[model samples]
Target: MPSHHTPYAINVRGLTKSFGGRRAVDALSFTVRPGRITGFLGPNGAGKTTTLRMLLGLVRPTSGAALIGEHRYEDLPAPARTVGALLEADGFHPGRTGRDHLRTYAPALGADDRRVDEVLAQVGLDEDAARRTVRGYSLGMRQRLGIAAALLPDPPVLICDEPTNGLDPEGIRWLRGLLRERADRGHTVLVSSHLLAEMQQIVDSVVIIDKGRVVYDGDVAAVGEPTVRVRALDGARLAAALTAAGAVVEDAGDGVLRVRAAGAEQIARTALREQIVVTELVGEEHSLEELFFSLTEPGAGQAPATIQETAQ
Candidate 1:
């Protein structure tokens, strides 16, 4: 039996999964520390779902291990009590009421009927909403029900895949707060999503993958430095001058150059000194979305030429 007091950290080491001749995940490795929300991010075909399924023991890995604390998911004595996972939103029977669906799992998970009611409320599915069959529920409602089921056990580790899929703006905000609060209370949380913009607002750290491989693994804030975007009369000349002045310049098209290692004032002064007519110059913060594309987009650095076409 697993100890309740033990800290749970999701550790994936050299994890790989192959389908036929193609690899869905190749030598991927990362750690989801306790008391933090680690975003498992990638584009649509980047093996994010396959990786999460392997972590939950629904899919077997071809190599390496995905462990919570010291035990693989299947080896955990009371998995539901230790880890609550929401991998599929439409997993419930279409005829079952939301509250009844949760109640059905209660016995197997060792949770009581009261827990069903608590979780339903926690996810904002009211009594009326809970009584309706899942077939009649909207996508957002089903998403809430899935979250409610995951929360029923009040486990130490929570794993959710695309929890924000069907949420409205307000619901998305609520989920962000909920996950952050869960981690703040010392639980390990790993949430997978393909949308970089949504994950950017919540994750403490990120593990981005592409072509079934780990492209980046680190603090979200450390990927790129702040930069300034400048557009001038002679774009090539301005870029060259900025490059010579110890700034890394990237052509952003339309006569614009993204200049790093310099602020707006520095870029303005440099343009003036170089006798270049500046059209637009402003400080631009690089978003996680931008960094994600830079590392995972096709033809970009470190990404493969082939996109995953089957079973990713």
Candidate 2:
């Protein structure tokens, strides 16, 4: 594990990028704090990769700032020591073994062969796997090798783009644990992914974009309000009972009612009071997947205007 006396937060303010006549990222701004994992999410062509490239100083931003702490990535005294990034897994040379590839980058990061071995084991790339040529490696193996390279320097900040792309369920779990451990050590992590369900379980916060503009940026729990799901023998009667009780109820088809502004206990009591037989009653929170669709769906418009202004 690596330790940092002062961890840096990732900050982007009014960050904009345009290619040709079209805008890729428009006035995007957000902060990713140390000791937490922030999910950078969007649909295809939403400029997630563009934003990440700008953050790493790979592709220059047309306007605004992308700062790692107070300095831009290229301005960092030792960029590799400050931030380790995995932008793409296929950036490797096909003929080089994983260990050799890491060794080649070690000198620049002031790391030794021993550190390389440590990172390889950390990412579950055993010695045998490390010695094989990249061309012979599986997609999952390549992903792990990329991660190992990122961790070789034990940098305080990490940025990854779609890191779970080729991972199996078990591999995904391993990556989650690895990221959690880094954050627990007070390291900053910004990960971009389309795996909304898996992200809901791993990330502390999320920044969702649509059409290259921020739609939602906040804690995952705050994305949407919790609702109560209830099924009754008489669907019409239950709907009326819940409505009279001041709960906004919707007929969710097949005798199921989705009730908002109320809890399972309240719904149950209301049904009992009205002599309505309750067959099923469960309290559920809106899932990350649901929230993503609601914000990005056509005609969904943008999230509340205040979210873009006050997201930090």
Please, what is the whole-model Cα lDDT of each candidate in the order they appear?
0.84, 0.87
- The sequence of per-residue lDDT tens digits that candidate 2 reaches over residues 1-312 is 344557999999999999999999999988999999999989999999999999889999999999999999999988888898998888889999999999999988888988989999999999899899999999999999999888877889999998998999999999999999999999999999999999998998998998888888888755555877888888798888778888778777787888887898898888888898898988887788987888888888785333334322
RMSD of 1: 6.3
TM-score of 2: 0.82
Ten contiguous residues with the weakest lDDT in model 1: 303-312
lDDT by residue (110-181, candidate 1, tens digit) is: 778888898898898999999999999999999999998888878889999999989999999999999998
Backbone clashes for every candidate come to 0, 0
Clashing residue pairs in candidate 2 are none
- Shift of residue 132 alpha carbon in model 1, Å: 1.7
User: What TM-score, computed on C-alpha atoms, does each candidate reach?
Assistant: 0.79, 0.82
lDDT of 1 at 305: 22
Can you list the residue pairs that collide in candidate 1? none
